[model samples]
Target: MSETPITISNLNDYIFCPASIYFHSLDYYTDTLTYQDSYQINGTAAHNAVDSSTYSDNKNILQSISVYSERYNLFGKIDLFDTDNHILTERKKKVNKIYEGYIFQVYAQYFGLTEMGYRVHKIRIYSMDDNKMYPIALPGENPDMLKKFEVLIKNMNKFELETFTQENIKKCSHCIYESLCSFSRLKE
Candidate 1:
């Protein structure tokens, strides 16, 4: 809320739904997510994997796991923070088995936290498939990656949408917001 141009949460808002992004920008971060949420599951898996494999605290590489950058107001959990190496690792989860793109989450973390003066070395994509994990590493603060992420969030923020438009899209498809969206009233 401190006027950072980017944040991990905002990136997620854009990913889920543009309307969600706008609502959050207006300071509406509620408990709309649950344990069964796929996004949570994927992110947790990625975090856990990195927590176990990389960045030993005893070595003085990582100060904390989920670091909150006061400068950019970016809240994100880093996979590995190599303070000694001056590097950071962010985990990205793909919706499909094949790794596509998760730059928004990765770079938003970098761009935001970098504003706070942390040298980010890499953003790793931890792709999941057949109950297995694949590690893909990308350079931190890549202009191409940052630009792509920025464009995405810009689109999400610029759009004006009716709060209830989701109802017409997939209200009957096991949506959590069906009732809140008033889809039930339409059928009645």
Candidate 2:
């Protein structure tokens, strides 16, 4: 509502569930009282450690860090950016499968950096689980995906409560909004 740009995290949330975007836009928060998830805590620690290492002894390896793009209205803290080599890396927690949202988030980072005049040659992801890095083929701001994202944002801006639906019941079951979600399939 304030003309603030939508973040890559917001895009990831929308990919997870359209209803999540709607609920978030309304400032409706899910109850986290019953959960003590360690995954989030570990992720934060990992990110901090990486950030510290980058700015401390290995600063030169990363360049053009924490870049923002005003044109696309997206911002991200890139883990590793080698300007001369034209490579960008995004770190992620361990998971069995790499989701489309992860790829798109990295792509958004690429879009932002390129718009700012950095030629990003490659995109990579560091997985905490294996302590290994995986290369991702650069999508280079695919117009099809951009169009879809724009449509989603436009629809979400309308603020229709009914836009929240039980599209993925399994994911909905684990959602924090499950208890308060009237559009849930569990209610049937």
Candidate 3:
């Protein structure tokens, strides 16, 4: 793998559509094309407290902290880390179902923190919309999923736009970069 680390959040985006990452790298800006849907708007709004690093004043509850795993070559900001209880959480605006992407995100954070000498006994996802917490099993408990996550990291390290294709038409139709992606199958 190259020295450059992969952003942990991009793992979720990669799961959504690899082409979106290519467009994101372009840094496009247009008033009409860059529209924010309700989901996007709500997600941003939900992250405000963590983004501002004011979610909590307690030292045990860390929010919006950067974490990195040199072993996995991954780096990203974690939403919350409870030192007192050794819980790592990734909060979402809402969740209809617990997707693999969500699991991978928190798993990445868990690995990053543990690699950095932190004891993350539990991993979780918090839905701001319903105000519920869902716990995830540790990677060791799920060897198959951990192997898949390892493969994902390896693939991301050598990602190529030409070879990457988003095969899910349903996902393409709802993607924010649908209009911008050349591989997008969404038809107006």
lDDT of each: 0.50, 0.62, 0.80
Q: Rank the candidates by lDDT, best first.
A: 3, 2, 1
* lDDT over C-alpha atoms for residue 152 of model 2: 55
lDDT of 1: 0.50
Error of 2 at 138 (Å): 1.3
lDDT: worst 10-residue window of model 2: 36-45
- What tens digits encode model 2's per-residue C-alpha lDDT throughout 105-150? 6777787788878898999877776787878777644567566555
Error of 1 at 13 (Å): 3.4
TM-score (C-alpha, index-matched) for candidate 2: 0.70
Better of 2 and 3 by lDDT: 3
Query: Per-residue lDDT for 127-147 in model 3, tens only?
Result: 888998899999999999999
Supply the global lDDT for candidate 3: 0.80
Candidate 2: C-alpha lDDT: 0.62
Best by TM-score: 3
Q: Which candidate tops lDDT?
A: 3
Q: What total of clashing residue pairs does each candidate reach?
A: 1, 0, 0
| Residue ranges of candidate 3 with Cα displaced over 4 Å | 25-43
